[model samples]
Target: MTLASQHPMTMFGPDFPFAYDDWLSHPAGLGRLPEHRLGTPVAVVGGGVSGLVAAYELMRLGLRPVLYEAGELGGRMRSIAFADHPDSLAELGAMRFPPSASTLFHYIGLLGLATRPFPNPLSACTPSTVLDLGGVVHRVRTADELPTDYQAVADAWDKALQDRAELSSMEDAIRRRDVPAIKSIWNRLVTEMDDQSFYGFLAASSAFESFRTREIFGQVGFGTGGWDTDFPNSILEILRVIYTHADDDQVSIVGGARQVPAGLWTRTPGRLAHWPAGTSLSSLNSGRPRPSVTRLSRTGEAITVEDSSGARQDFAAAVFTPHVWTLLGRIDCAPELLSVPQWTAVERTHYMNSSKLFVLTDRPFWRDTDPRTGRDVMGMTLTDRSPRGVYLFDDGPDRPGVMCLSYSWNDDSSKMLTLDDGQRLAVVLRQLKAIYPDVDIASHVIGDPITVTWEREPHFMGAFRASLPGHYRYQRRLFTQFMQRGEPDARRGFFLCGDDVSWTAGFAEGAVTTALNAVWGVLDHLGGATAPENPGPGDRFDELAPVDLPF
Candidate 1:
């Protein structure tokens, strides 16, 4: 195969080529609505990235956006600081970001936040990586240093991507934002691959004939670690991830990922339509968002939102950005808000359970060299042990540091859901001791351990959405909710926007792009139009829309 054919294509997926941040930053501003609609109020539920982006953009377009959140402002992008060392943080939600997430990076850059390359397994940022599988330890400084069999497994993955997915062509189109090329390549793949699972794709490929190779690939995946949990998920989802290089060239915010939304919450816009020159999202809400929306009732043209405190308010339109399950169960939503198909889509949405355990360390002791071997005592680790992945965070020699003792998902996370902090710590410590007998991890631990089981959290039932095989139709219905305004006024006024509603779930970029989609929806609903020079995603949605698969 030629060089181009040897690589898998990168796909922008449903995000397409729309640059939402650019549209919002346009000189003319998001197309003007009539003076009568300028001061109209709109309700934005779930004050996470989606809600914040929607509210901020709406406020700029001369609309009164009333934002509501049940818990913290950052939502899943939460970054918690240690009680003893406030400067350091342990990310409970999103930690790393890929450069392909242009929408999110736009906000990050606008906020002037600094980012450093994430120390993914076998990456240069990681001094070393230990792959402990089947009671065998393979420590390597790079992928080339891995055992011959492991190297073959990696090569097979690359070959499979090229042969089966057209990864190179897809990536080229995505990088150039070539909408036609992307659609031409991706539309065909959707028909061919939507119904398939990641594991099925692997099985069908010629890259791995032996079960051992397949098992090794699933058990110790490239980039972060094992991806066996994702095997049963839609191949489309996996394609989106690999195509966008979501697992490569990763970076994390200097302080925390949460700052992206938090910064936008308080940022002073360059242009203003109705609000004052220096008005920000926080100023618009008087520095406090309204309580969580407990109920949503639609009467004729308006939506009445009830908060946890029994307070009710009516708005011209409403945006729901919370997890689908929350909207389905936590809130007393009127059935008319969503169609039966939409409700079924929401009910059947699958969310992956994720858990993370972190501890504050006195120093970056892991960087110490082993006098005997002349290698760093501790590095990024991936093992079949209970603590599947171990990551180290160094904040200089003077300041205290943090260590993610264990980061797991699904059944692995479920195992630790009932364990207390001490118990979780003990489990991780024991696992680490087996992996690194010479390294004393427990001795460096300083403060109380912090752990989270996202599924158990009341506000967020799960960490992120992961679509199962044959669920493309359901996802399509969910994603296209922003455009379904042809019906009764009730359904027209209530819109859905979130990561779960996006084609690319579990990423901040998904939340941002979907929020922008809702912004355009709300704009069009209120009789606002996008400027011809800078058209929004809704403007070209049909041409660059997702592929429609036949069930």
Candidate 2:
């Protein structure tokens, strides 16, 4: 029987009908605060997607949320525009967004932004894909065109998922939003696989017994490219990515991915509580957000926050969305702000280093077809060479195009950190020329290359979190921070929300999900209520929650 026939309800994987947009648009709309609590001020740190989403939702709920940021508002959703070609953009951080990111799509639809299928390695948009490993180049028009050995690797991955993880049944429950069913399946898996590394899982699988097959799988992954670095990570983390289909059917915003949060910053709500109908997040902050938060401490029932400029204010509650290292090292946070275990969780959190280098081309030269072969001269490329992944962007035949020469992670990224922009561009161009000997990549370059090493950036210590094997207990403590307000001597007024604090880390949806959780937590702290008919996640958290790993 087909996989779908076995689990008919498994349509969209873990992306269920959470209806976050509907909850925000309900008649009561996240419920309202008491008359006296209206306009109660709340502090929001960081100006990234999470903090911006939290501030936006809180404002709609009759709360005055003061936002503080150390850098530009979009955070990792940064897009750099070419000097000569303003329409051409180079995404330094998040580029492709999966269709499974429902909460993010809600805002994308609301903002009236356009998106097109991203040119991932083997996607339809990618006219051709060249996979070069061990100096052997294999060109394919579709995934099926790949060599027979690659097919075996793909089949092995499928069999492993089904045999070890009960992939079909778990996915069926997740897609249907069957809370109890999901808990039952996920809880057992958490207990079974929590201690295993992704590499370990693969090694134990009978299908991947051949070391050569395993090596090929690591270098050239299924949807994207390369899983070598991820092999050391928790197997549970890999399962989450696969089960959610977070790596498939991805698209990028037409202008830039950063436009999502930037749009939210200026978007005016249809129905608001304390503010006027036209009041936007920008207007609420008097056209500029407060300075970055440098210190935080709890005094009585209120929390006091100090900014980089030494300005201070007290609020009943605060939300922190920056990398945990920022709180531990850059800011002077009081010990009482977090419990000992929570602090340990923060300290143990692992963030991956990422780097990208981009150049504006005079035209989409890669689209040109070679007469002899009848194939595009250049296409999306994955190589064992220094430049791991090469992506081409075409605005129009007449307009300038952008090319991401190199997008590397971890060690690949760190090696280039010491090189200046010019040096990095030279290295990338050399690598590209070596891969495509006939394509004159350097001559098409029309502007200076732009590069970003996320680790070297002081404001953002790293790109995103990647959980190590056996780190589930630490992650559980961090993910459950929103539920600790009621505990005695707990970090009552302070809440944490970010991709790092989510079960599925390193995705925009995770950031948005955790942000909404903090919003609900703040609502509860303010004595507000969620509508009974449309209960928020927090209202049913116990029933829908994932299993917590026992220490």
- Give me the displacement of residue 193 in model 1, in angstroms: 1.6
Residue 320 lDDT in candidate 1: 90
Model 1: pairs clashing at backbone N, Cα or C within 3 Å: 7-168, 8-167, 8-168, 9-166, 9-167, 9-168, 9-170, 9-171, 10-170, 10-171
TM-score, cand. 1 vs. native? 0.96
Q: What's the residue-level lDDT of 119 in candidate 2? A: 91
Local distance difference test scores for all models: 0.86, 0.85
Off by over 4 Å in 2: 1-22
Per-residue alpha-carbon lDDT of candidate 1 for residues 1-551, written as tens digits (9 for 90 to 100): 55544534332563355666567567777777888999788999998989999998899889989999998889989899999688889999999988878778878888999999888899888888888998899888999999999999999999999998898787877666677887888888888887799999999989988889988998889987798878889988988888888788788899998898789899998887888888998987899999988999987678999999999998999999999898778999999988888999998899989999999999998888999988888888888877888888886887787999999988889999999999999999998888789888889899799889999998788998999988888988888888855776668878899899988899888999899889888999988888898887878778777777765
Clash totals for all models, in order? 10, 0
TM-score of each: 0.96, 0.96
The lDDT leader among the candidates is 1
Query: Which lDDT tens digits does candidate 2 get at residues 36-76?
Result: 99999999998888888999999999898899999888989
lDDT of 1 at 11: 26
